[model samples]
Target: MNEQETGERDPGSGERVHWSEDGAERSALWRSESGARPPGKLAVADDRMTADAAYKLACEGTALLWRGDYHGARQLLAALARRVDRKPPKEGATPEESFHLYRQARFRRARVLGMLLVPLQISHEGTHSAYSVPLRRAPEVAQACEEAYGPPGEELTLVSLRELQGVLGAHEWRRKGVPVEALGGDRVHPRHGVFSPVRGEYVGLVARAPLPPGEPGSLVAFDIGTGTGVLAAVLARRGVGRVVATDLGERAPACARENVRGLGVQDVVEVVSADLFPGTADLFPRTEAGADAARADLIVCNPPWLPAKATSVLEQAVYDPGSRMLRGFLDGLAGRLTPHGEGWLILSDLAEHLGLRSREELLGWIDGAGLCVAGRLDARPEHPRATDSSAPLHAARAAETTSLWRLAATG
Candidate 1:
């Protein structure tokens, strides 16, 4: 979805399309004020357009409306993907350089491929006139489209094939959940916009790390930047007396709340909306005592591992601009610890390996914040990227180890 995704159009990026609104042909440069809208040059295509021509137009950032067969569009998309994968980036001097370049190339590839468009029929009375597109063998995607984009605003609207694919994928994931071994093999179904904790290494570290010494009934933990509430649920299952999880995104807090409710840990876990921590100067207010007492026996944060700007809302889970969340968590760690209590910082060495951040700078931030590394647990990455020989970043991936640094306040 990247920058092409729906929302306010960048000042000069939008152009009008001529289509019939009533009996007369009218011109409307349609732009979604909000929502995931695909950005590109658009043209209406019937069954006459060939796959080769469609591929060329898509590569040039042109979206084609399918007045064509439904199944044919799917095949054309596959052909376009094949072309994209065939052209790999040239090798770089180091894996780090190669990894960065590979990412850039992949991103552009995705942005272009996403230009393939799908049409939805929006009836005047606010219901779909036909759930199926003009294409043959297309499933009843009306419900899925409505669920993803909300009710259509006009007689017709365009959605990128990639976006619809995401909707369908989310539906499948919601139907059959992802298994989190940390939650005693319980399934955690992630809603879109919420990062799924399928990465076992980090969650494994959270599950296996020693619990701080305290009466079992009095232990409280905070799940900072909680996405799907997987960590919060894991904490609650491990018998933490209370777990408070916070997220600022419109979707994440609700997603986390649902996960907590579904896991039956709603009684022990409270999902709240906050930018980073529960209390911040501009957003939320608390008394000095309130802030002091809110410090928990444990605070856990797994921020975006990469230090890059996220162009879209969804990418926020993978890229943290200027290491904002990571630095914030460290800067506030000492203030939010209960004297003897610990802050569990779950991080990966990927950024350092990628030459994005340094070990000395990270240590300096910790010391500058008056926090010290107490004990650390490390786990090797088990994801496919670690062993994919064909992947450009395989070298960096092989050496990656995610760690949970037990941080304590320095006297």
Candidate 2:
């Protein structure tokens, strides 16, 4: 029999065919059983396709069926990334202007790769390729795909080619761990969907800040919106008696718990499910020993610094719609902080420079909320974007500085 005749058939309607010759050129064909020609044909060739060709096809709305080895597809993707990175800088752009552009590029990349992703239909019968994806890490990638897309049925399982790459990258990062010098040369492995503390300036600022002087038996701290629990772990290591870390994302709570346990700070840090401070306020009663209850000695919040709408759940960490989290944090700060205690607000001034939020307006909100800025420590951002002149927000990002603002309630 010819190669096409021996190929596997789709179990669902038997209308699709997965053809591969020498395990290199794989393609998917949707056909009618009555001998009618296939409607959709995606074939992967042996030669590497140029990014310009791929991108043009992507923009013109065509999918490149990758036939190269799984690893080769990855290399081609990297080449595409380099091309994307080399795009010319926007002239006279503000930081916000640049940020928008950066976000747009990312969004566009996702859109293009999403178009390339072919749907797969898996069953207990075993693996069947629909649109061929050169997945090197098949088991893990398949499992993750299942988790996100649900159990594969006879129907095709839809996934983004670009997002699959991102998931795989995240998996690797989680396995290897991100080096955190503040943890004494240790590393922190961030779980999927949790914010990773790659930008160390903010975490370092929190690490070096002054802790409230109190009875040293068990200092209590609340790490609001603890992403990877890095900040909470830092506080715990700094001799905080107990650190209560809270996050609304189910993934974040679990991620924080795992990291806290890995760091050996589980004894001092407790992970809880919470949307904000109110969720934890129940732990503190209105009357304790017939006196007004005391609040946490330290409340630290590192809200999303940008002022924008998130396109997806994952983007929530980077983009805060209408500055809701920032404003909510400031509004909630005074009530959660105990007398003589400080609320450390770690933030970036990129929004201010972008004309999204004015520095004067933020300060006004602080003062309006009956709080005083006890002290402010600033650190220059060291991320790659700061040095990339071709980036959209080069001017604003180049001038951007992150700050740890200590606020005390003054009612």
Candidate 3:
């Protein structure tokens, strides 16, 4: 069938089809680090393959090529997951250790199970084929495919069903968006891989925090690392005359721009593609924009607060090595603010509880940067994970509290 009918032209999906050397099987394929190597090793499975057998094979590091009815594959996948989740925790593990172990186990399970491969292909008729996927209940995920893989063109590639499901979830989140009452109940639609601002306390801090005093008609702020531009939009709607938002992620600038436009604050908010700040890495909002050259009356930064190694691209938003972003923001704030200005640092104490970073170290960095905490506001996390007793890090989560540090440059 033709690629167009199967919806290959979807934005970011790809333009045309690309094929393999032999012109038979998919050429481009990727699997999780733990999955079996080389697509050639993947053997096709059908309705006859029992879920127990599939589960055993998958657990033993064998990648499955599902050629059964689509619905059956999905059921198989679910059964596999149920089996994995039902496994008992290790004996003699402490509550804290158990949490860490659970996270590790779940991560490993996901990586191995992600080996179940699905294919997208075209037939000679150039018409939308039976999803090129066998199954009575398999869906036409052309749109999802396009969004995730772009147009693989004619190349036949195998993607994990787990990965496809993740893409579909992100697509749905982008389509429907998460509501932010601080933004007057408006929603922020996160682009693929961009961090979604579902946590409301941080936004509430931005909404309720007092704006630095300036001339009656003066209101300007800088939002560093504005992911979905939710904080920047809140400032603009709060009557800030101008707000400069900067982000470095590949899709973050576009995501922030779209959100600002949706919030009807594009005129007041500017989204810049940058690392840390616009120009110099040593200063906050260190730009040379002619009219907006002056230092800001208020600056806000919500850095990746945790100090750890990130295993995936999406995890980078939450994990930071050496607290780089946090230190950079603190280091440059003293030189970036007006006399009465304040640098609002939205952070959490999770890293401290996990022993990844210490309060003293963060405070030392702030002091070394010539900044001082004017005051701090705190809010406990409202996410269900905090209350999940089974969570490997439940103790840390329950004790976690997000803080908005009202910082002032020390002269």
Whole-model alpha-carbon lDDT for candidate 1: 0.74
The lDDT of each candidate is: 0.74, 0.70, 0.74
**Index of the highest-TM-score prediction:** 1
For model 1, name the residue pairs that clash: 6-37, 69-135, 70-135, 70-136
Q: Please identify model 2 stretches exceeding 4 Å from their true place.
A: 1-54, 62-68, 75-87, 93-98, 118-156, 278-294
Give the better candidate number (1 or 3) by TM-score: 1
Question: Among these predicted structures, which one has the highest lDDT?
Answer: 1
lDDT tens readout by residue for model 2, 1-411 = 012332345575555444444665444434221132232323343345666776666565444545445565556666666665666657667666766777888766655554344334354434652222334433336555543333455444334356666666667778888888788867898765666789999989988987877864456788989988999999988889888898895778888898999999998898998877635345655314433333688889999988897766567787899888888878878877767778999999988878789999999989988899999999999799899976556678888999999999998
Residue 76, model 3: lDDT of 81
Worst 10 residues of 2 by lDDT: 31-40
Candidate order by TM-score, decreasing, is: 1, 3, 2
Cα distance off (Å), candidate 1, residue 287: 8.3
